[model samples]
Target chain A: MYRLFILAKCDLGYAEEVGEKVSELEDVSEVYSVTGEYDLLIKVNFDDLQSISDFVQDRLHRVPHLKETQTMMSFRVYGEDIGDFVN
Target chain B: MYRLFILAKCDLGYAEEVGEKVSELEDVSEVYSVTGEYDLLIKVNFDDLQSISDFVQDRLHRVPHLKETQTMMSFRVYGEDIGDFVN
Candidate 1:
């Protein structure tokens, strides 16, 4: 799987709405409203780079209230603690 | 709960080892080795800002092989998909 970390800047007071929409998109795993240069942090996983490209250009780009985005590709997942939320 | 995203840079070939140690720390939820300016992306949650400060200064600082880190505080969790893995 190919994973990407996307930092999104949204219109003022629109982060929650933008995040909700982004999170519903295919491949989006998590979306958080954050305080910094960007308003949201999004995690997405896809089968290939082509799918990622399509999602970014065709789907993510269509999400309203999003002003800008910066994407970082994840090369590997070294550790994940699912037990934190699971029994 | 307060959440933080940490961007870490590690010494050559030490990301996995550093990530393993970081993941074992209390509050660390995820660690991903990624491309671009930072080597790893870490998600952590704590009860307050003081706890986050202590974790960064006392615990995360002691993780060997980690060169530097940049932390971003999360304001809210707009959306999450645990079902992707839980099912």
Candidate 2:
């Protein structure tokens, strides 16, 4: 699985609702309402790069009120808790 | 809590060792070995932005063989999975 983190900006007061909508989307593993330059953070898993492109560009970006998205493709994970992984 | 995702590029062939060292750091939530421009992905939780800055610059960046890092800060969590939360 590919781990992708998307930083998103949303319309004022729409973060919570946007998060709800985003979570329901296919391949969306996690989404968060956050503080910073971006208002929401999305985590997605896909089978390949093409799958990510289709999901983000063709589908995710179509969601209303999310103003912008910056995608960061992960190369590897270092500190994932072994205990957490076990559970 | 503040959520941060860090994309890291490392020297060739050092990913597994780097992952082990990173997992031992304080406030580090998770890390994954991934594929892309970067070699590892790091997730960290800090009390505030200042803590993030300190940890990334003063502590994390010091890990050997990991060449560079880019950070993304998150304000809130949207779809972190109720079941995951419940667990």
Candidate 3:
């Protein structure tokens, strides 16, 4: 599976709501409100790059309250750290 | 100033510490512990792109505990929302 990271900028005060909405979508593993230029961060896993582009680039951009989004696609993930810890 | 976003993967349970150390740096505007493929998300502003590369790309990765980093440079930011709200 391909893992993608999406940084989304939403209208003020919409981070929580937007995060919630994105998390409910299939393939979206997690979403969180964060402090930064981008208000929300989303992690999605898909079968291919096209699926990520189709699902996140097309559909996610359609979500209301979002003003901008920047997506980073990983070619290869390094390090044995993180993503293994459970809350 | 050029605004850059760095998604960093650190050793398990090191997110908070790494976030703190990066935040204490001069140009780092904000750093946050996040739940996602990346363990931490850092926002930094520099006088130019070179500074971001120097500070975050060079110095940040050298920090212990961090395993990987992906930098995203924004050309133009969109939307009129977020980044304006206060705690």
TM for every model, in the order presented, reads 0.86, 0.67, 0.50
Candidate number that wins on DockQ, 2 or 3: 2
Candidate numbers, best lDDT first, in rank order? 1, 2, 3
lDDT of 2 by residue, B1-87 (tens): 677777788889898988889889988867777655777767777777778889988899899998888787766666554533311
Quote the positional error of residue A27 for candidate 1 in Å: 1.7
lDDT of candidate 1 over A1-87, digit per residue (tens): 777999999999898899899989977877888777899998887777878888999999899999999889986766554542321
Q: Is candidate 1 or candidate 3 better by TM-score?
A: 1
Q: Give every collision pair in model 1.
A: none
- For model 3, the chain A TM-score is 0.82
TM-score of 1: 0.86
Question: Of the true contacts between chains A and B, what fraction does model 1 have?
Answer: 0.78
Q: Output the lDDT of residue A2, model 1.
A: 70
Native-referenced DockQ of model 2: 0.47
Q: Residue A4's C-alpha lDDT in candidate 2?
A: 79
Assess each model's interface with DockQ, reporting 2 decimals per model.
Answer: 0.57, 0.47, 0.06
Positional deviation of residue A17's Cα in model 3 after best superposition, in angstroms: 0.9
| Interface RMSD, per-candidate values to 1 decimal | 4.4, 4.2, 11.4
True contacts kept of each: 0.78, 0.77, 0.00
Q: Write the per-residue lDDT of candidate 3 for residues A1-87, one digit (tens) a residue.
A: 566778789898877677767777777765555555787767667776667768966678877788888776644333222332210
**lDDT per residue (tens digit) for residues B1-87 in model 1:** 778899999998988899889988888877887778999999887777788888999999899999999889986766654642321
- Please estimate how well model 2 matches the true structure, expressed as its whole-model Cα lDDT: 0.75
